[model samples]
Target: MTKTIVNSWNEWDPLRHVIVGRADDCHIPPAEPALDAKVPEDSDMRGQWGRRPQDTIDRANELLDGFAALLEGRGIRVDRPTPIDHAQPATTPDFHTDSQFGCMPPRDVLLTVGSEILEATMSYRCRWFEYLNYRPLMQRYFEEDPRFRHESAPKPRLTDADYHPDYLSDKIGNAKRLEWAAAKHFVTTEEEPLFDAADVLRFGRDLVVQHGFTTNLKGIEWLRRHFPDHRVHAVNFPGDPYPIHIDATFTPLRPGLILNNPQRRLPDAQRQMFERNGWDIVDAAQPAHNSPPPLCYSSTWLSMNVLVLDPKTVCVEASEVYQMEQMDKLGMNVIPVALRDAYAFGGGLHCCTADVYREGQCEDYFP
Candidate 1:
């Protein structure tokens, strides 16, 4: 009998198995306080809700299927989520929403640290049931991998008390939003341990968590308590007005090198650990476009949200010339994948996937 193997310590390891998301039946969730705060003031996604256009969903699935094939061609095993009906309304005792977010981006729902894949307690009311999309895969992993630890964080009761009403206002300009971010105030209060899996990045012995609109201080604390062996650090980027996940903001390409969004650089004080450990945190190149793709929730920095196939290889969006060139300059074999059209579905290469197995063990890079 073949042994069950599920292990991934950090981001840039030699990946063996992974989960690539699908865009089937994805939805543009209705307006909610947390979701509203993440959307830009003048963005096209504003006032939009319901199932996305079938044409767009088909295009996104084409890209995702092609991406999975590409990874399979590279000797990697890829598993896909069983996407549920996203148009189904999410109703809980604490709150109710017209619909749930899609399973197009599994990284936002599952956090893989070593042998454990934790299902995060997402902050958004619309995304409360998003984890259901990946339950089949998780069940398979559990049945196959005897050592795999499937854990779910404490479910957040996303009542009105969990969010700050001030962020619900559509007229809050970028200046005020920036001011609020700098003040360490976000749309979600410390009502519960609310966090999206994408907010945390695992680095062997250390975990770098983003304290932003999607994750509060309490969420970081919850992660710390959950992983007693890992040193959890809470980081905030004042430059981003609608900060959520950290993948686009801070990308670690390898053990000692990271790419930081030029617009949302990590604060100097937060740079101590990397600097002291001889790691280089360089500013990522400017995105090719000034604005994000239509109806996208992310900023232009999604250009840097690349998937590291290995330490020396990466997959980047085909149209992001500057980002592709930057990866080439950094000595990485860049695989140009067509995914810009799919960005509106969720995000780029990295966001659309989640790690399941990588060939390595936990090693303290900082110590």
Candidate 2:
């Protein structure tokens, strides 16, 4: 029998192989249009631009290493990304930024569907070249699996035309942000195709993508064209003031169940497909912390960013008591992993990892 290298059709299948990110040489990227739009106006990350403090980086690495070990203990194969020099500036002919984002979250860069792992055309100027961190792993996978298809979307220029200047203000209140989100007005424009891998969630034959700061309509259209055989759906959460990734807002635990961030609930119109298909979308538990970790770009909703090991098992942040309890009540075996301290590096459990192989083929659950 031939071994599979990359074949994950959905988020909740029995995970067998994955890639976990590292925090080595991570940096607090300098200010830019798209990056600034995602940072809360009152965030401590404001005005921060440099290599992260050594102690924090070391602690985050420790947590990540332990998480990898925990997964390995469960008989899952875990791979790590090769860290690039994030301190170096990202200079493209269209634009230039002082520094690059870290490789601490592989989920933001790689998207695996079927026997292929696609490198996303990240929207942030600082993250334009972020895919380089995972090239070595992609090479190895390509060599090992005869059927593996390594692909990359067309690289976006990330010019000034890609972002709307109105969102760059430091005083954009939540009310105004919510209003903009309701109107489907986002930071990124329709200049070119752009998307971060984390903005999308695969549901076998369907691809659910979040249309927000990091992914524009053209990007969603690009994905639709790229995956001609898959049904692509665009979703939005009007309550999110700084929407970027879908993992923190909408999580699929199994074929018929999902946990949605209460603060950023999926609008009713977009919920029709799931409701009609008999899937239950319940509100997720409130985050344990009142605020996110220091220098974090994500909101406190990372509590719902749990990684589903299978339909019956999941890994959640160790500090999220309410979230863990909710998972247990939902008939999931929750494995509490110590990773909140590392949230500042990138994100929670689901954010730092990307699926490589899950034990199932694609199935249409919503038909």
Candidate 3:
């Protein structure tokens, strides 16, 4: 049965940590000498592509401390130097930060397979610094050893295939190229896949559960078996392929209140589920053909991506503050966090930070 946090959103709110906002080695893949040289310098790749400069990453980390202080100022108990395991082999370069997305599960005390970082608090070892220094060494080690080589660099996305083919969108081909790379990065594995395995284990097995995905039903069954005590719900349906996680579809704002994209993902049944549960769903669907939902075009930075501070509040990246303010005026408290570099990954506050646990919930299931 799915556990619902209906009525009062405050009842099930969880704690969150914003990345320091600097580019730690963890955000960047081990420097490939050839690729590093080719990577554009001082480029807005972080802005356009969702990446950060090493310095910017450092700044982000510092800012997180200040932000933590600010959160503490509000009387919220901020957790200490919790790190995310960065060594995990990800589906792609972006996956390198899976720990950032998946590490938030243990606060509820158990981990389930496939739950992203947004939902739970992770084990200590899975935290970043545990293996922070190792990344540079690993990159240097790979450089010294000649056998490692990329099999084939992926082909760039065809121009017409883009969601936006007009001159306006075309002008930002580099950003589009990065996004294109991110999609492919999702599909390909690097020289080794074990990197992800080791990454998950670093966090501790209890906090990092894994399951086979022979089939979606089987996958859900696996997640259910492990977290039977918690409410189990599936966010992605057959038709909703783009917004891979629940955060992509429904962003909670203080319990029952949520920011949602009704047109793309929510059908009557799903909407009814919220209504039946007493959720005050805030429909954030796009306005006609003038602007499509960010998910469809893969630009989740605007209002689409954000971080939930509590059931009623959030810390969104600065770029989307305007929309967030609009949400704030609608009754939800929106706190804007700076994630200038992190956006290079094509996500913003929500995309960069994952929730590991909620006060009265069980792990959500994914296939």
Candidate 4:
């Protein structure tokens, strides 16, 4: 069973095999310090907590299954995680939650760098045990690939000390939030290493991490020490008040190009490396919808969270007309897929998948 399977250096490579998450048994986890701070002030999801509506779950599953089939049709090996009992509450000595988050977005929990898959120390209490959803696949890969290094970060004790009390209020408007963001005052403190896998973007010999609500300075430091061979850079986008994951904010379409949300432009200091290395960071197109789907945690900027099939091709949400047009103009063949109904489950296309094998070797793009 020892055959080559797990290997991926950076995003935008020609993906050969991947894991697509399922929407079954998705839930609306109870509001906690870190989770509540991320919920928009006017979001209808406020005070909502329980298993998601069954009809919505079904619709989401349908879309997810169809997406898997589409990827398989294109000759990519697609794997799905076995759904666990998501209704069960996740409790530990340090903390306890009424319910657990779903496994619909594997990208948020699993960081696949080269032959290793590291489970992130997620900041949200409800999502602390989310890695259980993918343990089976990780085991299988370990058995099948001799070089597959399945690793997990130290589980963080998400006690009260980990969050800032000021963000607990429900009325922190965009203005105050913007000011706080500019000062790098996020909800999660430096008490421990906490990060969502989606916050870290892998470049050859370099890892770019977002320092925001979900990922703190300590988490990036942990990643730096964990991967001593790679150069780690911590970046902050002052324009994003609720920055959690980087996929929707900064997307690498290929080696020499990236799509950034205009609302959260990368600071000039952070852009120097890319500019010096001849990389073009273009502003992503505005979303087609004025708002995100009901009960969704992501912003309207999920339009940029596209799945790159290869350097020349990408899969975008079907209704994201402006994004598709932008992709087309950027020389990438666009494949539009309907996925808005599934946004509430976790996220868009790219957020729902984790890379397993991409045909390439690690090359220092920044050097």
Candidate that scores best on lDDT: 4
Q: lDDT of model 1 at residue 76? A: 92
Off by over 4 Å in 4: 1-4
What digit string (tens of lDDT, one per residue) describes model 2 on residues 197-316? Answer: 999999999999999999998999999999998999999999988989999999999999999998889989999999999999999998999999898988889999999999999999
What TM-score do all the candidates reach, one by one?
Answer: 0.98, 0.98, 0.48, 0.99
lDDT of 3 by residue, 233-276 (tens): 33332223222234444555553465666543444664565667
Error at 216, model 3, angstroms: 4.7
RMSD of each: 1.1, 1.3, 13.3, 1.1
Runs off by more than 4 Å, candidate 3: 1-23, 27-53, 80-217, 237-241, 285-298, 345-347, 351-367
lDDT ranking, best first: 4, 2, 1, 3
Q: Each prediction's Cα lDDT score? A: 0.92, 0.93, 0.35, 0.93
The local lDDT score (0 to 100) that residue 299 gets in candidate 3 is 37
Show the lowest summed lDDT stretch of 10 residues, model 3.
Answer: 195-204
